[model samples]
Target: MHGEPAVLSVTRYHPENPIKMFLLQPLYAPLLFPNTTSDARDHCANERTFLSWLRLAIYMAIVAVAILVNFHLKNQPTPLERRLSHPMGIIFWVLSLACLVTGLAIYMRTVTKYAKRRALVQTGMKTQAVFLVVSAAIIAACALFLAAEVQASRQGHAGAFDVTFVL
Candidate 1:
């Protein structure tokens, strides 16, 4: 092998099952797009971030629905409990809805911005930081709301935590 000039034959591999290829195309799609420039990598990263935001938004929505369902399943929810869960559940739902909208809007905006090549990588970083901060604040607010509900339930007093102030 060493004396034969070590010839290597390379061939593109295609899956025999079209269905499997179609299903898995997304996972390998990134490889098809070469990142020859920094902007391309940045754009790719931005897309991944956008998808992450979408996933987070979906998770938040699921949690909100779960809260509502759990409360309804209870034999009885006090007036205060109902008041708290109803409003908080709605708030979570709204936040998640906003997240979805914001994700799409930001993704489009970023794609456009990068396509124009008017901004630098620093701008992208700053935008990501801002998004993260906003997400954290919303999550913190949700946590406080849930914590209050938990405390109220444990104390046997539905009004132990006033969610209005947090709102």
Candidate 2:
């Protein structure tokens, strides 16, 4: 296909059903809002940081939910599942929940303080960007691990349990 690299022909393939057509529209919705105007909000440095932190908190919540769903979807029997699902899973959820809550609480506190320190300006571009990239990778790992467990259970494989040391 000798053509411009950036140009994609959307008309080449048509949706085979109404559901596919319905889903395709939303996939391109963001492209349709190129000039959409954003609503006014706190633009202070601290406020922005706080908002980004809250976004991180939401991501952590999503990660926790993914883990929870994986736990509940385990195909093992109740006794076996209860035995396998203990300190490790509990610790994971607890740590994630703590991080999410702490991030959100600090974000709220910073927003309140920002209202008073409206003139203060501290743009942390480098630190914020680095933390965002690292934390997003961590969340992606959690998502991948959970998805792996789900697929394993679907294929009738025992989860990564300690079966070798049952002496």
Candidate 3:
């Protein structure tokens, strides 16, 4: 047994092919069939964490859509207004994309962590540094968004609460 190669022999499934058992068994077994109840619980928790990240990504995507839809170059007669409008729109667009990409990156990282933890049976909690970094980035983006809005309003593009009632 010491000199024998490491191989999983599943007589009921693939007795004829030991290679398939060696390759596919370990990879799928934990996910498909947990050895213990605690393993199943851990997997469930991992899935929940993954879903939380996915929800955050979706929220960020919604924010991106809102930014794109709400911030646009309206009718501007002056050259300064037009210049400011273009750059402001560009800045908003970049920030929107940054938020979306960062969200997706975080989601993907969570997925990787989940998979690794599942395979390794690790019980370590996620670090607070990640949360702090993400929070700071979000706060900065919000501040920039508000600043741009204020600038646009100051440039007389449109009143902050300008509303047109079409009957």
Candidate 4:
């Protein structure tokens, strides 16, 4: 509307898995570029950061699912343990679910071929930065959940072992 418009170019898609890539974009896009830019400086944000977040999220989620899932669960330990069920195990499962869902959501949001910069210092930087923070935080949460679950399981196993040993 004013002077000549500036050029805005975005790289085309070449994800590891074109389909799942979109499912993981929200977690990765902002992480890669906390600030939207066509910048060519080392200080500037890059795509690697975004992918790393996704990597961590995926890793944490898989670990969580692996640890929490696939027990026959026939009158089984009530998720956590006998007493009240292990809170950490339940929490870990919930966190893992959240990570998977959130990652899918973000990835879906960014599937399109190009995302233009509407205006300089507009929503992209602010929005993407927020997304990045959220992605990182989610990963951390997943890790915490896993940690709690592991600790609880160890305690449960130890308690059980001690009781048997007493006999």
Candidate 5:
């Protein structure tokens, strides 16, 4: 305490106790900043929220890929059907990218908010609800488009193709 800063005063390591030093060095280590401003709980919740959004983004990407794959699985979709599928897949992928960016932005903003606030404040659920509704609407519209195309394709081929069982 006399001539040195408090953070480095406690950083001494005993040569015989490497394990303790290894474990405790972090407590006394001096970095650019003293330490993170937010508490452990706030940081953890923010991370969980961020990770959940990341998982959703990844799921959206998978669904986007699957949508295109499903179109290819069909024997022969009409030109219009192929073109529609392409846009649907691309839109889904774009949504996924948006989700990733939004999630990261929210996480960073929340962290900064937590650091500056003296008390906890709840975020608006309305925004979350709107996002969910819009995402679901896009997915539902895509599904309906694909479904209609399949129905039309089936109806077009129903009478032309015949299958018989010999067994």
Candidate 6:
């Protein structure tokens, strides 16, 4: 036991709160045992990167919500408008979920690498950029779908109700 690090046995002290202990153990481990300044900075940077990804996920989710709300509130005046709205809504929702899952996956990967004390600079950038590119592509697809929906809606409205100026 001379060279071995001491481990805190949470169950020994809080026998009734096993779930709390399990959930919080990892969170408090760093505070309990301080690491070198470089390690601390690395962890902080990792957290910042995770937050950035989380922010992007949130933004995408917001866009999905906006699309959902728009479809819900707006009355579809024509059959074409009604038909296009449903698929566009689905695409936006799926894109949002994909972004969220990808963001979480990247965060988990970075955390695992950091825990393993692996060099994260090169690997992290490449993986993150790939995810970003995929997310961007999905977003672009959603945008195109949205544009098509808008165009169809406008055409439907024009054909159904637009007044023509004839001399």
TM-scores for candidates 1 onward, in order: 0.52, 0.32, 0.43, 0.31, 0.57, 0.53
Model 5 CA lDDT for position 132:
81
lDDT of 5 by residue, 5-115 (tens): 534322233323323432445566531212355466666787898898798789878878866765444356556656666677787888788778767766755654543
Model 4: residues with Cα > 4 Å off, grouped in runs = 1-46, 69-90, 101-114, 119-167
Quote the lDDT for 26 in model 5: 51
- Model 4 residue 153 lDDT score: 57
Cα lDDT tens digits for candidate 4, 27-123: 4443232245543342222234345446655665664454455333332333333332234335454554554555444433443222322223222
In candidate 2, clashing pairs total 0
- Model 2 / residue 120 / CA error / Å: 8.5
lDDT of 3 by residue, 1-167 (tens): 45744343232333223233335544544223323446556556656665665565566555545444454454323343344444544554454454445444443443343333334433233434444555665676566555554565565645554432212
lDDT score, candidate 1: 0.57
**Candidate 5: worst 10 consecutive residues by lDDT?**
9-18
Q: What is candidate 2's CA lDDT for residue 148?
A: 48
lDDT of 6 by residue, 1-167 (tens): 45645454422423233234334544544223236448667767766776776776676666666555544334443354355555655765665666666555655555454444453654456556656765675677566655555665568688454332212
> What would the per-residue lDDT of candidate 2 be over residues 1-167, giving only the tens digit for each residue?
85533322224323444234324543543112111222124434444665665665566556555544444432443343344344334544555555554554444444333333332334345445545655765675556455544554554545443321111
Off by over 4 Å in 3: 1-31, 71-133, 152-167
Per-residue lDDT of 103-130 in model 1, one digit per residue for the tens? 7666656544443444343345545664
Clashing pairs in 2: none
Answer with 1 or 6, whichever has the higher TM-score.
6
Q: Best candidate, TM-score-wise? A: 5
- Winner on TM-score between 4 and 6 is 6
Off by over 4 Å in 1: 1-36, 71-79, 121-167
